[model samples]
Target: MAKITGETRLENVLVYMANMGRELIVADRCTVWLIDEAKQEVYTTVAHGVREIRIPAGTGLVGHAIASGEPIIIEDAYLDPRHNPDNDRKTGYVSKSIITIPFRNNDGTVIGAYQAINKMTETAKFTSKDMELLSLAASYAGKSLESVMLHQEIVDTQREIIATMGEIGEMRSKETGNHVKRVAEYSYVLALALGLSPKEAELLRTVSPMHDIGKVGIPDAVLNKPGKLTDEEYEIIKSHTRIGRQLLKGSRRELLRAASIVAEQHHEKWDGGGYPNGLKGEEIHVYGRITAVADVFDALSAERVYKAAWPLERIERLFREERGKHFDPAVVDAFFAKLPQLLDIRERLTDKG
Candidate 1:
């Protein structure tokens, strides 16, 4: 047995299969076609004298092997109804006898097909030995392809989980009306506008939405109050920020950590008059400051059960009036600078439902 090294395994496998076909007096133009089940197509992976080709399953001889999961031997190409002449025409190679064998994975699932065309010295008819060798090669190819597909499935599942969590957050706050999503988008845009790196912008986008996640713990009466609250009620309402922080605390994940900061300090004012520790100017986390501006802007513009939607002009005026008092000066400027783009997003994402 020959020692199989890492770098040349694929090349060696294909060469070995080609030589086996030659020794069996089959075709000189041997090729291997791997089936991508997800795509429902047969793609040539290794070709000796033939140009690699891709064909829909069940369309040609190779397709027959894939569809039937059985080997096929065509001693006369012109006479066999399963033979496809387009391949030879496209590649400008004359066709003769052809042999195709199914490649199955370890679990006996067909992963691809191997095809050999035009024998070098004899008719291109597959012998039992040719079938045996090609089947073995196909098994190796199939297993490799399945592993890649399984890994992609895991990645796709993780993405689905994240999306589901975002949807759950949106469902919880009927008053906010997609507030989580809007804040995420607004924070993302603001971060980019403030000259943060792209990676930081994405992190902020995901983390900022959890800013009001603490509202989940607040009572319906406090969260959905339609009128002005009494001092005591307002104080209870203020506890949400703290609750949000507590809920997200101690996560090692950077996004979750950022969420904890945003949840805790977003309510803190620029002049040191806000609640939940009243951290002064530049004393609060930058994420908290950024989310403060985004949350306020969205809250003002979006209609909630508690308040009517402010007009675009009113929202703009409010931002200007509260610049140094409510929002960080630099963040306020970034907000106004990107106002037009924000309005476009608002228009596109109007809460129709």
Candidate 2:
């Protein structure tokens, strides 16, 4: 389960399963092939040192095992009629003993196949014990795969919700969806470079877009003013910080709670000149600091109702000059360090409208 949830990528989960299968079964190599019934294909996500592979369902020993929902063991793979030597030929691997097991879901539907090849033994033949271990592991893999998929679906749904809400916040203020997109990208890179785990980085990326969620609470007169805001209107607009926090409060979901922190503190400055509580330096939450840099960068890059987009030269010089003044010095460094990726994200998610 740690292996499954620890990974953000599905292929990485399959890679973990295959590597564990090979080690547990004492085989030279292993492959984890997930079935796509609609496509009638068995796609290999990971194979011992190989990149990937795919074949039609019921094509080889592994495929047949999956199609029939059965397990197969071969003392000599080359002698087995169902064995497919094409993979070995391509990978320059010699076929020997093999075992293929079908991984069935809770409903007893075969979802995938696990194959271990060339058992490492004096006789180079797989033992019954080897088959049993692999079978048990394959079953666990199937259940873990199910859990991982469900987790992925939940995460995707959460992302969709955050994106939609962020878009609403931006659109209400006359900003484009690309504004939120750039913020997420910039936050994502800063998070990773700051040494957060992949899972944490991904979470920060998803929720960072919600930094301006409180904007939805600001009156359109203050939020969408084409001209400079009056002093009264400025104070009213700044209340978006507390408003966003209140809007996102009380959610048990980690994403929402994290988003609340960003929304509440994204306006805070490192020098204690920022609004809300005026959290300064490390006094501000790291999430807030990271999102602040991302928010400011993207805001300056894009044209806004308040002002035109700043020239890149001015933006870069300001980042350098404002280090530790407006933005966190470390975060600024990470921003420049990952500037290329940040630029790529800007280009990739450029606003069409």
Candidate 3:
């Protein structure tokens, strides 16, 4: 499946469900809840006029339907035992009439619930026409949400696979740690700071780990040498940049294509002094430039077999010292500008190994 764009897809789905529910039924409040099967809960805020609220199956009007696999229409919420006024009190909404439906798939399995409360007509009681409109909307909501959720699941699966592959590469080189995760997050921050769009930034976050993927191709003797490598071994190590690019090259996927560029150019110095290609300054792609700063910063701050983590001051000094030569000056500035966030990420993702 193709990847979905932006962080707003889920949010947009919820908002649209809520809006449609309100417009079609002319209800004062419409609440859409996506089920959490493991937890046996349906929860949401989406035009519910409250902070996130979660209810268990068989608890309220909506909950009862979710549990019983049926729908309910109550002319007066207070008159019905199945109706729960707790949500009304919590949201400062007075629900007089309500229509709650269980959103089911083709096999009639309940995946979600939709409720429209307080019909706008002075009569207030929900009519047959109202129920018809609502049931149709509920059906559409279930199908629409299913599509969005599937897209989300696919995106999550792809990221996990990428993470596993990155870990394998790091493990092969004996640099076992949370290096990939940290670098991905750091690259995202740098990408955003460099003014890349959110979609591009997220793509960078997912694929940045592959920057060192070529290490898997290196021999153990050279990869895990205890000290400085001999000139030949060092040259061999430098070839990893080209190797990584070639490994990721020819992918039709955008994630792999961006990764290919980063893999090849991350080692290139801004001053035309790096290995493999010696690409200079702006000649290097922004993905490479952003990944370079993140890789170097994390590699320095992180613990290594041959060296311990650098002091924070030393790390700061190096960013300042290498601003234009080893790193792109603007990217370095962005790194320091967002240092607090970076430090927080490092703390949260600290290597347990």
Which numbered prediction scores highest in lDDT against the true structure? 2
lDDT of 2 at 302: 86
For candidate 3, what is the lDDT?
Answer: 0.84
lDDT of 2 by residue, 30-73 (tens): 98988877888898878887777888888989888988888999
- Candidate 1, pairs of clashing residues: none
Ranked candidates (lDDT, high to low): 2, 3, 1
- What are the lDDT scores of the predictions, listed in order? 0.74, 0.88, 0.84
User: On residues 31-139, what C-alpha lDDT tens digit does candidate 3 reach at each position?
Assistant: 8876777887777747566778888856888778788777788888898887778867876777888888888765667887888888988887788888888788778
Q: Going through the candidates in order, what is the number of backbone clashes in each?
A: 0, 0, 0
Residue runs of model 3 more than 4 Å from their true location after superposition: 1-8, 45-47, 67-70, 89-92, 105-109
Clashing pairs in 3: none
Report the alpha-carbon TM-score of model 2 versus the true structure: 0.86
lDDT of 1 by residue, 105-200 (tens): 668878766687765555346566666766665565556545544654654554354334545555565743467677778888899999999878
